[model samples]
Target chain A: MGDISKKDRIITAALKLFSENGYHKTTVSQIANQAEVAKGTVYWYFDSKKELFQAIILTGIQRLASKIENRIKEEDDIIEKIKLIVMIYLEFFDKGRQYFRMFQEGMLAVIDDNFKNKLMDFRTKQAEFIAKIIEQGKKEEKIRLDVDSKDMAYLLLTMLTSFNSHLHYDNDFNIISKKDTIINIFLQGISR
Target chain B: MGDISKKDRIITAALKLFSENGYHKTTVSQIANQAEVAKGTVYWYFDSKKELFQAIILTGIQRLASKIENRIKEEDDIIEKIKLIVMIYLEFFDKGRQYFRMFQEGMLAVIDDNFKNKLMDFRTKQAEFIAKIIEQGKKEEKIRLDVDSKDMAYLLLTMLTSFNSHLHYDNDFNIISKKDTIINIFLQGISR
Candidate 1:
């Protein structure tokens, strides 16, 4: 805490508080207190709680995308890369369950247009990241050429989100088996 | 409105307001006004706004389940039944977009334990409905026997939800083609 800047400390404190208490319940004063700063200092960094939340979401998206990119940088097999991406997503969300809650809140709540657009941009960026991988697979002759990469990317991301929700809500879900199930179903249809 | 009972009128009014202005913004007075009922009448039928919202959600789940059951009653092919189930879900949510929004709200918001349990029940009921169809498919030797019906059912439902969100948010999505894509991807692997 001492080494890091006040802004980073504020973000760290806010993330913990937000995840624990939720968006509406959390207050800037609490965040400032948790970050060991004054309320005025907190406002100096962020205009409002909503803007602070937006920053967290947007930063989270970028961090996740880069983490996925970094993890799969060396994997040559496209199928394995896809599987890695799924696993990383599951693990990432499992750890940062707050982001998932915030995402649902952002999507469903009557938020302003600017925040909504940021969310949209997050989705598009994520899809594009996966779509690029699918395109690479096509180039490598590993993936079928008939399917639309962009559409497939979106569907895959959606499935991952669904699995994430299950992981959070359903206590009986076995993550290891479920990971295999997702990869298998994605690569091979369920049809006999 | 005249044909329905007072309870039904209140439910209808509540759903519309909840969907239009969201759950927190809507008030009992507004609901009574919309339903053309006295405020006491609304209170007589429902103890509180939260209870009214819960009733709406529970009724919606039952209605959707029965609708899917009726639509696929005559479809003999298990695979075709599954397809019809997907189509019906898309159509149902498309028409009653409010339900989808409410679902998101219910899942993410820090609501009461009973409401959360009801939501879990709604999800389980939906999955079980599809799992029954998959079981039938397995008995008919149409779907692979190795895959767990319940898990597959959950996955299929998740995919449908992903598509529903897309339908509501993404203006560029082509429903006709997207339906075929989901069916195709589910029925056949993306791999050639």
Candidate 2:
């Protein structure tokens, strides 16, 4: 339990620094100092800085996935389920703005192939989750059968992430209104 | 005339290098060598590397804007004009994949406040341009009157960019089919 706590501390500290600075600029030494652990302990806990960064991202993705799973477990309506999912995402990123920033940095940075592959895998899995919901919507006759579920899921997720980033940049925007707009547009589009 | 050619060569070489190796990794000396000009020539044309990058982005945006304007000048139908705009964008990026790559890098990198602000300005202008189209559609009774044109435009542009980046990473995907899917989703959505 102590080891787990220590590792968590390192991750928490590293995430703050990485998000505040950047992946390339943040050093393991700074993470160790912030976490109040010796530099050697940092190395003992993780093989390298890259590994530590990967661990932070993995933990974030897992946590978010579990949260969404728990929130939507009782919801049967496809449209309601999607709304709940979007709300969960907005609230998740709102609280974990640092994590969102780190994720954005990870997305854009020409990091190593391994890191890039991992990010892509995360996105693919995310889209797959939404695609399954879309498929369920189709089965329930709530969604259009002509459109490809996977493609729609991908585009929907893309819009969600993009909107989330916009929220991060501008604080004056109302989240509830924006969320409704997104849902409305996704379901009905802009055409009369 | 000779000086203009030299400057153009430098910009071309810098764009290639910056896209291949990121903005941070590519040096002015390397750009000069690639352009077959003296290192001092690069500095004479631009104040700094950042300025050079800004110039490339500005030039790309202007060129794209002109092409889009020229193509849609005679088209009276809003939907057809939108199709033309999207096609022009796809073709522009397809021909200048290097510029698109550099733009992505610029979007993600925390180079400086000036650079970030400039990118945001470019996006805002693009969104505004799309917003005008949405307004025209609404007037034509082709678009829903309830939606905010600016917000809708912003979302539409975001999806276009996200899809463009996806194309950059994947080669097997059919551009025409994806373009159709995007337009269909934007206009009709996925609901039954």
Top-TM-score candidate index: 1
lDDT of 2 by residue, B55-85 (tens): 8877888788777777788899988877777
The TM-score obtained by chain A of candidate 1 when compared with the true chain A? 0.85
What would the per-residue lDDT of candidate 1 be over residues B1-192, giving only the tens digit for each residue? 448898888998999998776675678899999999999999899888878887887788788888888888889888788889878877777777767666555444436777767767877888898899888888887787777889888877766665555444454555555677677778774222
- Every model's DockQ: 0.42, 0.32
Every model: Cα RMSD to truth: 3.2, 3.6
TM per candidate: 0.87, 0.83
Per-residue C-alpha lDDT of model 1 across residues A1-192, encoded as one tens digit per residue: 358999999999998887776665677889999999999988899987878887887798789888988989889888888889988987887787766665554444436778767667777888898999889888887777777899888777766765555444555555555667667877774222
Interface RMSD, one decimal, each candidate: 3.4, 4.0
* Residue pairs with backbone atoms closer than 3 Å in model 2 (clashes): none
Candidate 2: residue B78 Cα off by (Å): 1.4
After TM-score superposition, the amount by which residue A57's alpha carbon in candidate 1 deviates from its true location, in angstroms, is 0.7
* Every candidate's lDDT: 0.75, 0.73
